[model samples]
Target: MQMLPLNMAAVTTVAMWKAIALIGLAVAEAFVVVSSSPRERSVSTQLASEYGASARTRTRDDYIDINRESGGPIVRYDGPTIRPLSNVRAPSLDEIWESTMPVIVQGGSLRTWSFANPQVDAVQVLFKSEGRPIDADIDLWNGPDNTPHKMRVYVEDGARRTFSAIIGTPRGPNSIAVRNIGQLEFPLDAVVRPDMQDGLAASIASVVSKAEVIQGGSVRTWSFNPVVQSVAVIIKTDGRPLNSRIELLMGPNNSKQVVEIYTEDGVERPFFAIVETPEAVGSVIRIKNTAPLEFPVYASVAPYTLGEYNFVGDSNSFNEWHML
Candidate 1:
């Protein structure tokens, strides 16, 4: 090999290029370390926590959990979730108003009553007996046309039977006829009312009212007045047990803050709850059933009043009614 003279300038330029490449690699590594640091991680974790909290507040049974093995957050949802009734359309007050009267029927003859208002769409007949089992048959006929629009037969033993029937088209005048076909005389109560649509809408709009018989697997919601201090909910089931849940929404944003579970064993029971501080302008209550079969369910709400009570030495206590 022949020896050649070395160029110092060229050697210095190569050293400079190597130094620049090493500096670039160091800068890239530093950038990755800063991105994965505790401060950055904490920011992302906080954002996730806030999102989870907001989502859980809107639903009845949704939450976040941490995985034990992996130490990672997991979201879980157990449903039949309750929702607000703010957007539900309700009936007018006049539609639900009932002009109820007492009716008595004897023998196997039919008795009819002509509507004083002339313009009506529906009729409700409620029959009750105290002695033996009785059967009642009811029919509704529209005036002028004398068209038999609706009819029903009810057979029950010392129990109340209510039949609500509708007339297809509006009429100038209408008549409702009821008869006791059983061996016993029946004492009954009758209500001449408007269509059910108006009544149902009115009930949902009012703060303290009764709801119609709700079928299984259906959900209903009611709104409360702002001045209400507390509310009492009464539920009645027809024949089978009812598995239901109630959710209460509070605050302006209507967050699901309170929850109640109800199991009705073919009986009437009342459930009550109190309002929290900084009372909500309005609150919403939702009822949902998890059963597969359809059953008759009625719910009503009323304001709670506090009164004085005197406790005697015995197990019984005397309660006095007084305005709070």
Candidate 2:
């Protein structure tokens, strides 16, 4: 055999090693691709378990450790990125209502609370609005003792608020009067008493009457003698177009309190009529469907005397405040 130069022989040896290394790398890449498949990974996992490796393989192309702890397979992350937890706290009902204090209008001449106690002349006014804040004159004169007491207070609106105000004693019956001082009308609620918040002592509402569907051009009537003062009348269109009239008759004279509801968009909206009766006498709820269509109606009258509070509702002008 003819001998080659020593440098050339060394170069040839280096080239042979490089070619082997490249071939090995290509084989390794091909094995990776094949093992990454679901079927191949499953088979590999089964074989690993049979051989005492107990390897766990996932469907996704995850970077997993094998024989990591000598007992079980390690799980690696190959899915979507996980999000960190948030630390911000949401506002409570009381905090949210406090923030609704009228920006431009500091206070109003509107008298919000009126009470006539033989011992106390002024009591705390706990007020809340179902919708946005309403600027209204509350005519609290509901009885013989309720002298002409009218006050304008910025009734903070939203959620079930129990904010208190120090105003003259609320007048009339437990039920008060609300008139929209602003051009627009909104649902308003108020509780009058001292040393408490709304619903802190109020009883959980009990269902006096179940839901009933009233046909078009018909009337559904319910009568009950309330032992307490507060009565909640709920009317819903059930997502159907509705134009109806709701009447709450109470007192000896049978004073008719009417609410005309018309849902133009056919949205399933429940209109609440919180009726503060003049007395715990005989009360009647009469719903008449003025529209020529069928609609569902429900009413629950809970007559509970909140120990330290007078749970009252607006008697007149629900037209201005019925968009609950």
Candidate 3:
């Protein structure tokens, strides 16, 4: 009787295992069915459509449709008649800025141009591709700070894309870069204009402030033979986001003053103090930059006086404080 019960128990266990195996197989088949659905496959096409109205949904069967379409950069209509202008414009290098150039970038490459003068307020990029659509990112940097403003663009092959502007500050040299993030290599005609005409006259006539600090950090001490009566310091950080502590010391030992300032991310910190001396005495000012990052500090001293624009030019630590 005990043996019979043991056999029955073995049979029950086998039946349970079979049921579990069937359930697992059903789940795997359901997952496959969902993943291969038409809805899942259309995701990429939907994303491409959102980039622009001209962007077409590309697919394996749609290869003929893409090829039938003509691609090239868009031409600007500058006259009464909408005729395509010649890429080869004025015969002089000085007039090259008013023309377009044919640029071919292979798959997975980037082109960078540091052709912008400080007067260039913006850059205009108009491009069209042949055969295959091109995907690229337009990068603009105000200076060599390595921080770039990026915009993603999609170009339909054989069709002209609308020109896009990369805006930047008119201060310092700007770098315009185009990165091909797509897998296809094709010829593209691009009209890139470094627009410097707008506000050019105004910029030339405008007086640049001498109060702007050059660079900060490193050397921090300044000693003057006859100490100034008062000192002020202004600290501003670049956009990289930083937290730093700045300590300033000024005046002689008898009436020495120490000011402690803390800077949080994105905020400018300031410090000011006056020195009291029984007589004309030598004074030293010290400043420190704990978060020593490039473009970390913009410093300026107080009281307009005829002194070196970089008054603290000799200071080893901070460039913002100058001996009057």
Give a tens-digit lDDT track for model 3, residues 200-310: 112211221233433435435545432233233344455543333332233343213333333233232122122221112334545455555564554443321112221
- Superposed Cα deviation of residue 19, candidate 3 (Å): 99
Per-candidate TM equals 0.30, 0.32, 0.31
Backbone clashes, candidate 2: 12
Query: Which window of 10 residues has the lowest lDDT sum in candidate 2?
Result: 77-86
**Residue 273 of model 1: what lDDT?**
26
Instruction: After the best TM-score superposition of candidate 1, give how far the Cα of residue 140 lies from its true spot, in angstroms.
Output: 2.0
Candidate 1's residue-wise lDDT over 130-234, tens digit each?
544545555555556454433334433333213222332244466767766765455544444444454432332344455566677878776654333334454
Please give, for residues 1-324, the per-residue lDDT of candidate 2 as tens digits: 999999999999999999999999999999999988876335446566665542344432233223344442222222212111112232222443465442221223233334444343333334555546655454435465643333343433323222333323323133344454544345444444432223222111232335666778888776643232335455555566556666656544353444555543233233433443323234576778777755544433343221111113222212222111
How far off is residue 309 in model 2, in Å? 15
What's the TM for model 2?
A: 0.32
Among residues 3 or more apart in sequence or in different chains, the pairs in candidate 1 whose N, CA or C atoms overlap within 3 Å are 90-201, 91-201, 91-202
lDDT of every model, 2 decimals: 0.45, 0.43, 0.42
lDDT of 3 at 322: 37
Which whole-number lDDT from 0 to 100 does residue 136 have in model 2?
Answer: 48
Ranking by lDDT: 1, 2, 3
